[model samples]
Target: MGDILLRVSSSIKTLIPFRSVCKSWYQVLSDPYFTRNLSLLISNDYSGKTYLVQVEKDLISSPTSYSMKDDIDCSSGCPIGSCHGLLCFERNNSETYIVNPVLGSDDDLVIMLPSMNTETEVPSLFPVRIFNLMGFGFCPNTNQYKVVRTIRSTLRVYIYTLGTDDSWREIEDLPTDRFTSCLPGVYLNGALHWLTYPRIESDDRKLEIYCFDVETEKSHQLDLLPQLLQGRNNLDGLKLGVLDNCLALYIKLGGCFSNFDIWVMKDEKCWANIFRISGVAPLSVWNRDRVEPLMLTEDGNSLIAYAEEDDERRLLKHFDVRTGKNITNRTLIEKGTITSGRRYTAHVATLMSPKHIMKRSTCHV
Candidate 1:
């Protein structure tokens, strides 16, 4: 029976009912080893749903959507980060939640994480500077779930370990004015990757891809940041994504930003060029400025990308690597489904319970 559970562990949603049927079954499914394996979800046969978000005009609720499943609305904004099928959301600039949208409306679905920005910190006009540089990831070394929040207003870093730390604890060595984008860092191989803010010292100085190892809690930079080192448009050329569990870069060449080149990191510094898409590579007038590659599909043929339109709207597109034309209905997530500007984290469905992942409870049935 335990062997049967292990065999079906990959489809976590199927195991949820059995965990309640017997004590021994619950023990096996809840084992850290079982849940930890889910963290390595990226695979060649990847069929995980890529959830998008549409933040309501009232700023009240952001409905999480996937091209596959449009009705999966959760509590708050688009994900701050995603790992092992759980998506984290920030609400009202104060409350945060880690939710499994697959378990929609279930009693044990959302985990309300403790707030990091409280009102009592030495009052200044801008008392809340340390918001937005937040991310959620899985640390393989410990088989633990962690959220790393970098204070954008200041140079401090704080980390929260679920099922362990109830509060956000400060960590050292955070980069000042780096980790610029409020969007969650792309998680791959136990680390989060983000393109740093462009350097202004020289025209040749391009943006660097920064990485933070979730296990060690240390930060570093990646090499050959897929762009021409000397062009004025260099810094804006590269965008990040994860393909086959590896970090991938989408480079938009030329001034009009039409020609595209995709590369995936084989190691810390080694990048292997994967594709080059030419002519109308989904860089429409609406989605030119804000576009990102989501991932390489399971078949290893085309790439799926996310783009925000002109007026805080969003779209997801797929382009053939060889042709570079928009294959709107050819891929898994065919349409962008018109969304808000909120960052949409790639989501997969799983039954990782907050009760098992967090030490404390605010996630009630």
Candidate 2:
């Protein structure tokens, strides 16, 4: 019986559906040992027409057996927040809910603003036009959760703590010129970073970054790096991620091939030009003119841009901070024909090896 339990433990998530095998099996499945190893994987349906997929990692390796399951139903305007093993999802009408699909739990959070909903219409003022730019993070110091929503470049910041009667409290209304289009906000080092493109009437295109601190609930500007300022069109690029915990901006410069330049913030007021990958090489080709394509891998270590070669679709892959490359022809995912043109979103995670999970249990037991 213990041997059977051990085998079940190796794939706890996959074995969950088969817990009715016997009483003893049920006991083993309900044990803390099994639940502790369960990993929650989440990805959004960019069209907001389908429910997000939340699957247990234990079953993912055996893709044939572990089919990905939809965990949460999402609307067009709902913003998502991920922390620990749960997601903070809020509708445009201010209906907030904390859901942990893996645990089959959904907790309704109270409204953050006191009289705003009844006194003034939220949609009229702060409409949910774009869901991609909303920023959500957990603050350990306050034992609370925070969300940042931008409306046509203006920012509305909200925070919610556990055991608090209020759902979200609006801290401030940020100016409109500080927010960028299609760029996502990242929460790191107690602050939220947003990429913005500000242009004056007679001034050249001044690309800037706006940062908001969760502690102080204040917004400040970080100095643009020289290389970032020199880029042909920084706004045309996409927000990659933070390198070494600093904000990393990926600029797409179009020439004979697509130019990818990475700029990292060196200091609060300064930035450093980190790396640049130019031209389509034997390993990786830049898709200079592709529509609705460009993927950041699950680990954030690789960038996959869709390109074409000899009438066949290919993906130009760059790994290890955009160095060491390969052109994989296999399609990670393929979708056809959609209704409304929604913002492009990517959600992927590295699937752990079953051998690694076995080793983890051996060390624990």
Tell me the spans in candidate 1 whose CA falls farther than 4 Å from its real position: 1-78, 105-107, 120-132, 198-205, 226-236, 281-292, 305-345, 359-365
**TM-score for each predicted model, relative to the true structure:** 0.70, 0.60
* Candidate 1 per-residue lDDT over residues 262-352, each given as its tens digit: 7888888788887765553343222444555655454555666665545534455666766766665222232434333334434544555
lDDT of each: 0.57, 0.45
Span of 10 residues, lowest total lDDT, candidate 1: 39-48
How far does residue 323 in candidate 1 sit from its true spot (Å)? 6.0
* lDDT string, candidate 2, 74-112, tens digits: 554354444333444555535555444443432342222
Q: Candidate 1 — which pairs collide?
A: 107-365, 163-358, 163-359, 316-336
Top-TM-score candidate index: 1
lDDT of 1 at 354: 61
Runs off by more than 4 Å, candidate 2 = 1-46, 49-71, 101-133, 150-162, 165-167, 229-234, 266-275, 279-324, 327-330, 334-365
